[model samples]
Target: MSADRETLEVYNARAGDYAQTMGRDPAAMASLRAFVARLPKGGRVLDLGCGPGSWARAMLEMGFEVEATDASDAMVAEASKVEGLAVRKAVFEDIDDVARFDGIWANFSLLHAPRAAMPDHLARLYRALKPGGVLHVGLKEGTGERRDRLGRFYTYYTVAELTGLLADLDMVTDDLREGADKGLDGEVAGWFTLTARKIVPDTEARTDTA
Candidate 1:
């Protein structure tokens, strides 16, 4: 079955429990910190599908202006409880702001979007970023989709597939890696992480396009 509103609602109902178990994976933390280090000082960052605001909190603590959004109301509420955080309750498809963010951290979130929906989602992310903005995406690397016992849908990606998608939008990848990490289940999980920068036109091209 396709993941719909009800599926998300179910996930939200368990948000607290999920937070307790997978609050912040250590590997995820390291990846995010590295992504932040490459960004300009005090840059505006958006945490797409930010669950419980862990990464958002980290970025805010680092002095970046961080804004977050999640499709689950329960997750949003939980994220808001974190001090000094702006958490929006909205789906990725609802995001419409353009050229406003310097960086976007979509850690382990876009996997919920089906393969067909990813291109449009990526386009929206590209539009939301300023010229030369960066985007960091994390996903489980595999062949198909599945839902774990917790009922959240996940889609995996191969490095080549992901790179091709980003390239189609003219984004230059700064980093990409695959590795194993502990999963919400008790087993090790394989995943891929990618960081890419929005390619901007040079002065001559910008002037002409303008």
Candidate 2:
């Protein structure tokens, strides 16, 4: 089976347990909060591939207007059930908004996309963001594609690999960190986390995604 289909099938089959067991590290949350704090007050945010809407809920509580989506219908259903959150089902390449978001969060989601599809998705994500928009992403560390014990397909990247990929999309790096920690499945894995900004030409000295 294709990695995309395999991963989605796995997520659809395990959405309930996945949501139930999802974990939030205080430090990670703090880091996210600090990153989004840079946006304009009550900025609009898109939680890309938001599973179960945890970060969507957090962003809502923090005063941002949050829109969310995931490729998995089951995951989207779970996210939409949360109070004040209405996530839709959508795939990575389908994001077509132009300068529409102040921030985009792809926490542990984009890793499921195959390596070949990454640049295209990244380009779409870049174009979807408003100038100066913040982009946050999380992925595990490894060389390439593989399946976890749960049968979910994942594409890993080194910190340098991630940097090169984002720069190829013309994104400006704000922060990148690598660490080993327990994932939601209660298994320890090396992780890559990054916060980057879109800059527009001749505007506050920032780069443009449009």
Candidate 3:
């Protein structure tokens, strides 16, 4: 799914400030490390909507083959500044490869897409991963879509709503975490991160459902 223009513009203009505001805490660092440990050494990973490439850079430093992507030009530029990082400009819909990545990091990125488009975008992401590949997503917790004070669009989802969506696509939820935090707009919002794995097929029925 394409990113909302105003939201994209906000990120592009504040890429630096955004980067400065984001740094992994002890808990976050542990989560990242846990995710890395789940993957094969040097496995291919896609950092979807990688704003400033912080997570992508961390993964690359850990010796993974990383590809970072964002829809904003400035975000892409910032990501490119990282030595040895391979970043590109593209929307979520641009992910067309099948079973290519061993992991997909879509943290807080897909929230910009319209609620109605979430299923299709997720389906695309699911298709991009190899069987048994891992997917991690972070999203604000709420019931509807709205524009934040910063003029950036957001689509919120309840845990049950999101869990159902993933279940429909045959993704098995593995880990879940929830809390509140201040974002670029200085608002404390509740959010949740879910890590899921694409189930390896045991029969033709599994592949046909997706």
State which candidate has the highest lDDT. Answer: 3
Give per-model TM-scores.
0.90, 0.90, 0.93
On TM-score, who's better, 1 or 3?
3
Model 2: worst 10 consecutive residues (lDDT sum)? 201-210
User: Which candidate comes out best when scored by TM-score?
Assistant: 3
Tell me the tens digit of each residue's lDDT in model 1 across 118-196.
Answer: 9998999999998888999998888887776656677878988888999999999967767887765456779989899
Candidate 3 runs further than 4 Å off: 203-210
For residues 1-112, could you state the per-residue lDDT of candidate 2 as single tens digits?
1238878887788889888766456656866877788789999999988888888888888899999998887888889887888677888877899999999988888888
Candidate 3 Cα RMSD (Å) = 3.4
Clashing pairs in 1: none
| TM-score between candidate 1 and the true structure | 0.90
As a whole number from 0 to 100, the lDDT of residue 160 in candidate 2 is: 84
Winner on lDDT (1 vs 2): 1
lDDT of each: 0.83, 0.81, 0.87
In candidate 2 the C-alpha lDDT for residue 156 amounts to: 87
